[model samples]
Target: MTGLFADDSEQIDRRTSRWIRDAVGERLQQCLRPESRLPTHLEQLMSELKKRDPEDDSH
Candidate 1:
């Protein structure tokens, strides 16, 4: 039989993901503005990501 904790963990995971997705959408909407600044923001993000791992091309 499955334990009660399994269902609770699954529910928690779903809730956490939904919250994160919504938060990201809201934050991105606020950050991505003026239309022209999109490229610069993207480049900055990419540069930061590359610094973490030089071979990370999946970004």
Candidate 2:
């Protein structure tokens, strides 16, 4: 018989990913204070990156 969760590994992977992300983010933010600056070629690089990548609202 087919199980209720055809793929339990997927759920476990997602939960693990979220936990790792949250833990890393909290520690990194605490270690690094606010430091913001952009490169001179940022605009050109950004255009290229956008063309080559799909954006995600993670940060």
Top-scoring candidate (TM-score): 2
Worst 10 residues of 1 by lDDT: 49-58
Clashing pairs in 2: none
Compared with the true structure, the alpha-carbon lDDT of candidate 1 equals: 0.59
Query: Which regions of candidate 1 deviate over 4 angstroms?
Result: 1-12, 34-59
What TM-score against the true fold does each predicted structure earn?
0.36, 0.37
* Model 2 local distance difference test score: 0.57
Q: State the lDDT of candidate 2 residue by residue for 1-59, as single tens digits.
A: 98888977756454565566558656756776668434558547645644543332453
Query: Could you tell me how far off, in angstroms, the CA of residue 8 lies in candidate 2 after the best superposition?
Result: 14
Task: Count backbone overlaps in model 2.
Answer: 0
